[model samples]
Target: MLEYVKTILQKVSFNAYLFERELKKGMRYLMPTELEEFKDWCYATFGMSHQPILNRYFRPAY
Candidate 1:
C-alpha cells in the first residue's frame, strides 16, 4: 500500500490540481461510494482536504 501511494505521489508531483485530476481519472471504474471513500482515505493519509483539492481541478459533471 505504501509503495502504491509512493508511486502515485511520484507521478502526481505534489501539485494538488494534477493529483486531483489524476485521482478522478484513475477512480472512474470504481463505484461512486467507493470513489468517495477512496477520496476520503487519500485526504486523511495525505493531509489534504478533499473539497479544496477536488474543487481546484474537477469541474462539475465529471
Candidate 2:
C-alpha cells in the first residue's frame, strides 16, 4: 500500500493539486504506524517541491 501510494505521488507530482489530493487519499488508506513512515518519506521525497502542502497536512496537531 505504501509503495502504491509512492507510485501515485510520483505520477502526480507534476500537479500540486493532484499531489495533495493523492496525499490526502493516501493518508486515509495508510495505518497510523505507516503515517509516521509516510510522513518521513513524503518530506524526503517531496519536501522541496511541496513543502507547504506536506507541512499543512503532516504538522503535529495540538
For each candidate, give its TM-score against the true structure: 0.47, 0.93
Task: Give the least accurate 10-residue stretch of model 1, judged by summed lDDT.
Answer: 1-10
Off by over 4 Å in 2: none
- CA-only RMSD, every prediction: 5.3, 1.3
Clashes of 1: 0
Return the top candidate by TM-score: 2
Predicted model with the maximum lDDT: 2
lDDT of 1 at 1: 38
Candidate 2 lDDT over residue span 1-45, tens digit each: 998999999999999999999999999999888999999999999
Q: lDDT for each of the candidates?
A: 0.57, 0.95
Report the C-alpha lDDT of model 1 over 22-58, residue by residue, as the tens digit. Answer: 6656565556556555555655666544456654433
